[model samples]
Target: MTTKPAIIILSASVLAMASRVASDLGGEVHGFGKRVPDGADVTFDDVAAHLAGLFQERRPMVAVMAAGAVIRLLAPHLGDKLREPPVVALAEDGSAVVPLLGGHHGANVMARRIAGVVNGFAAITTAGDIRFGVALDQPPEGWALANPGSAKEVMADLVAGASARIEGNAPWLAGSSLSLAEDGEIDLITSDAADAAPGRGLLYRPKRLVLGIGCERGCETGEVLALARESLSEAGLSPQAVGLVASIDVKADEAALHHVARYFDCPVRFFDAARLEAETPRLRNPSDIVFAEVGCHGVAEGAALASVGASGELVAAKRKSGRATCAISRAQQPFTESNLPGRSRGRLFVVGIGPGSDGWRSPEVTQMVSRATDLVGYSLYLDLLGPLANGKTRHDFDLGKEEARVRHAMELAGEGRSVALVCSGDAGIYAMATLVFELLDKADGPDGLRDGARRIEIAVSPGISALQAAAARAGAPLGHDFCTISLSDLLTPWEDIKRRVSAAGEGDFVIAFYNPVSKKRRTQLAWARDKLLEHRPVSCPVILAANLGREGETIRVVPLGELDVDDVDMLTVVVVGSSNSSTVKTGDGRTWVYTPRGYARKEGTAMTNTIPGDAA
Candidate 1:
């Protein structure tokens, strides 16, 4: 489940309330309708479909609407409560906060939190949380409920005027109004577990255990997980009590460490060498070689001890599996996202925002941009991110300097900050993604790649390209075989570009031209147009789509003989159709340009291509 919530609002009136809630909760606001509201971080038209999609993605939602409306809309998608994320509904005027679903699984708590933001009453319907001041089944972070099935029964009795007494250490639960007494009618059991069943009452496991792991570069995930389980078994410790996974900062990008954290269902924290070195005295098995290599005596033990702070003690000695090590430390208290020090693995998303329109952009790209702590991109592209970059630290650059912009994003991500390198079109298609991979492929010399930048996690999200947006605007102009060529000779030789254009002409392919023209370079588009005309007919359609999917969008279709260079601009993507391509007037008198992939000739040019008696 995503920690960040999506605040969804229907109209412009509730936008103030939505933004206020977003400010307090650190969530992105989604405005639904034709024209996106000014303050919305994201926009969607179809509320039902969008909510279903968000629900399936397991994203926590705070819809600023009636609670009954939300319940009715999501009732069809609701099923097993265990897998659902929190879903809360808020009044349009910010007067009431209600958790419509997932009460025990965080909705109630989220509702209360939202209520605090608006100074409104939390209409928490969950009887347990209302009476006990906590979600009994869903414990707080760094803790787990072993016997969730017993919570309802236990809370029922407690709410029925019965008192309880704890069987083990649970300082975290001291604040909850669970009606406890010295000699209580019921019991609340706690254990540092080893697959043991509860003897009596509701069983809860506090996150007092820390799982520390160290592995060689590119270590197998299974091996690391096996060692963790083995180490836990050896120490007779419960994986449930393992609150956090700790590792050296150098291993921040290690897939094995992340997988082990997933296995324990805990957050992983990375410690710098200096921090780990300070914990050298607490290490059960300090190593000179480790100190020489990573400037730390021991990665596993030091990281574990450092996570638990001054009161922590090593409960399990360093255990090794071929290329990995594991150690356990018991903390005096449980862990949380706030209390845990040291950086987490940095994340870099090379995402394409698509042709300056929310409708054209993918949801994934928007989500990534919202989640990003920093956005690095050219000035115009950064402006295209709209409200998603509202509170983010934008590292904006000029039109040129692509290399510097990407490098800065990597460096920021290496500092454990989530960074998004924004691009206009598809990231992989003649964009900054290639530059990112090239930089990563370089040797890790001092002047080359930095250690932190090299170890950050990077992801590339596909965006609607200029070619796609142009083709879509011109109906099905790219229905047949197509090839794209960038007319700019800055990267490739002009001769090489001409050769590719000539080859595309010979192939009779629908061609999409990127970087067709610029202020200083206007002749390339005319030259390419003439080149394609040599192989295709003079009557062939040439689509000049300027500022596709952006404001003042223009789509001009002209025959090859009448194609004008002056009509195109730097933002234009010129598509030259194949010889077989044609334009036709639809029933509504709307014109469409399409290159048929021989569906007509193969079936004798008849509208019906099926055999006789075949179902239509």
Candidate 2:
């Protein structure tokens, strides 16, 4: 079941109260403007527009304000009651709580829950809910409604003293509070796809089936989708009951098989040939030819039984189309992550979190961190993430242990765990990504690494580097040409650093210096400044930015001659301009720095601008 996140909106006056409610309710908080609550994850400008968008997206919302404000903003989007998301309104001081929409679709339940959080009263007005203590249309978790249109009539009959019949083997039917009689006019049937018997009845579908699929290369995806749907319909199975799709690892990239999985809205699992061949003794119709070709007796049936584990049984034998095959299995136990070892492929994500701010962090980095089973980074860098790193296994290392950190992350991934190796700036920019690839190259059979480390899948997610951050702070300093040089000789020799700095000066490139000067290495920045002075004049602009996108940030533009060697530190990025770069003061009395692209020279002679040899 997918639990949609709830959004709590409040004005600045009641931000503290709303923050308390939102925290207790376990959802995201959104404030109107400045002076937002301290715990708000996001802030917005226009309340009406944001609320309407939330309504359209069908996300549950709790508005801590007058009920009229919510209703007026949501009136234009008020269409379907059954499909609409839950909407609740509460008083600022926790007095009254009301369900404004989606009463049957969890609004009433959410209202009561929020009321409990606020120590107030829930105003539930639905008649069936007050009488029967359950919503007829909305089934319990892991249950789907076959036809939602019949819920209203059945609820009406039940509320009007009409007896109901429970005509299925579902255990939930025994605990239902509805008036169930041996023979009654209204029927409630629990089935995979049981049809109506000339009367009003609600069909509740349970998730209990797993579909296994195998397809040839270049097979049409539409054919597999249609055949799978037809087989489910013929077997009296609801598409909603599909738990997963299983296949062999060799067919992991088969398009048709994945398409069928998507149509059923189920996860796809693949088993290696060794695991599949282990199940040959249990095959109903084992083929020697198939075993010889793919090392498996059967792909569909073997994958099905393997995915459902030891207690499951094959309900449908393997059925074939022109270029595809599928089978269905029923599990004795509930489907869960424990039954998902058939698809445990190792993956390692090397990511950069950018500077230490929520605003500067990319969405991809957050998602990678949240999905990772292990996080490996410097101790200080890990501490910057705060609550986002909660509940994950942290492998913190001191600085200068980059090789050990990347190796540990890869070892975890080799054990079939998802690992994220975090860096501060961009991962590819003097970060751990290169070290990961280097370790993989050397892990061939030596260097005391696990044999599986070479096979773990790896990906690099880029982030905003410190040079880009510094350039953005000082407007357009890198507009023409630029090159970055790290002054640290810990990795590279000092002779090479001096050569690169000298080359950058001769080339007249806008130089962005990273790792400018550390505690022990104080002479490199001064040497580079003297070297650059040989090409550009003393009055050239130089922008010094330190701690970009983080606390204690500062940006100062100074003349090249006044470039303070004492002020430069390891955390500072110095961007020195070229000969064409200049500064101008705007109407707001702020200095802006930019390098001209030589278009001004042409603009000054625009009237006489002509191509050479254009005369007759």
Candidate 3:
């Protein structure tokens, strides 16, 4: 969604207009079914539900429908304007653009942008935007309003024939239409220091302050945050005036520094030790211990001066708590995200795509993948991403080399790149999550893990595993106790696999078999079937689910005695039900499987024909 907005339309007649707008704005077209156009990105059946869901998910939307319809659809969810995403209502011909909600937040900006693309009219209705050409509540980027409670009052005062004077060097305020005089009754002050406030006025803050932090590895979050607050308070600097939190690159994955950045709602940027060492001459409080540790004369003050450039100097010297250090510097100019140099500490997301289907993919996974700059996975798994992998730099390893791909992903992210180590199904369940941690456990020792690899943050996103998908596609075969076993015996010993299977058989657990068979490994699946028959009856249900959520998918229920190894493959998960499992024939001529969780025993319907065609 960062690249493509969701462009929703109702009919094929409007498809041409939608396509033009989509191309012009770099958005994807989503439409209702049947009437959905051939070139649409996605299609849905229900309009109201789809609109409500998109609003709930906070996806940026441009609906090609009547304003009343969209208003009625989203009016129930209009409480928090700050959290709402831009929702623009476009004319069917792409002529007029109206922002029904989130006008100042982002909708007005998007409306004007779209109108510019199509040479259309963007309806501006907000009084402050229309009269003064600015939203007092929402200032331009790199500027923060210190006293937001005064915005409504100041706007009203200006409307009622009051003149204001700007004391600071704010070009945006000077360019607005507010009445001004040499000495006016209302004061609109803009300064980086908190002490610049007059007796009574609206205080606007330029984001010129930089807070440079250096903390011990694995320090507590509260210690760094408290030191930051105390440093700003002691320096008479507003926290709103801070634009960046600078730190050394080695501590990029440190949680304490990140917590301080989050507290100020500012970005955290990192500098390598060499870069920090360059600013040693400007450091007011240089240290020899730090020089010996990280090859920098100082960390907190050196990073602050390095961030603010040569023209700026540190306003507050090195201030430290027990394990954390803090310093403040005023930049020569307000620093925006674009104007800031350097990169973030990289992140590696160990994601599970849930059987290679977009519909089965979680929203969290989709959002994270969109933010990734690189992807590392198998060729077929990367191909399954479809449109999501369009702009990504993919490093597709062959199916055999799992360790090689993980190593590649870690290295890329260690270089300050956003990387995703893609895996199929749940990454934790017999997948790459364990391998990533195992590598991290013995990192920077012998094998290929560099020292920077330890500085990259790792997050694991869960997905529906093969066993869960098979159980859902068939019935509830895993209602009570369930366990999974991989039969490949490639990395694991066959003796250990046999012991687990025999123990699970004694435990009466419904067994889900993964990696059922391969071309050369066909005997294990047959041996497991024969061994499981020793405990349960031959009539026990066994589900063979192949290609679970992808094309050419198949699900079959057969008896335990009739289990065939030829029908099972790496893509298939074979689930052998327990003794209490039952197979039922519905009136619709379809089959369903269920294992009673003893609810039927208490309800006195254990073996009764309560269902229409359930076998007794």
Winning candidate number (lDDT) = 1
Q: lDDT winner between 2 and 3, please give it.
A: 3
lDDT of 3 by residue, 296-339 (tens): 99889988988989888799998999999999988888888578
**How many Å off is the CA of 488 in candidate 3?**
0.7
By lDDT, the better pick of 1 and 2 is 1
Q: Score each candidate by Cα lDDT.
A: 0.85, 0.77, 0.84
Per-residue CA lDDT of model 2 for 190-263, tens digit only, reads 76654543368778766667787777777899988877887677677778878778888767556787678778
Global CA lDDT computed for model 3: 0.84
lDDT of 1 by residue, 1-616 (tens): 2468889998888788788888888887889856455778889989999999899888889998888889888989998889888899898777888887788777887888888888888998888778778777787776788887787787787889998887788765677888889888777777777756554477778887888888999999999999999999998888788888999998998899999888888889999999999998777789999999999999999998998899889999899999999999988878887787678889999999889788888988987887888999999999987887798898989988999988999999999999999999899999999999889988365557788999989899999999998888889987777999999999899999999998998777789999988889989888888887777778888888888887888988899888888888888889998777789888997677998756332211212332222232
Task: Please identify model 1 stretches exceeding 4 Å from their true place.
Answer: 116-119, 168-172, 193-197, 445-447, 586-590, 599-616
Q: Summing lDDT over every window of 10 consecutive residues in candidate 2, give the lowest-scoring window.
A: 599-608
Predictions: Cα RMSD each? 3.7, 5.9, 4.3
TM-score of 2: 0.77
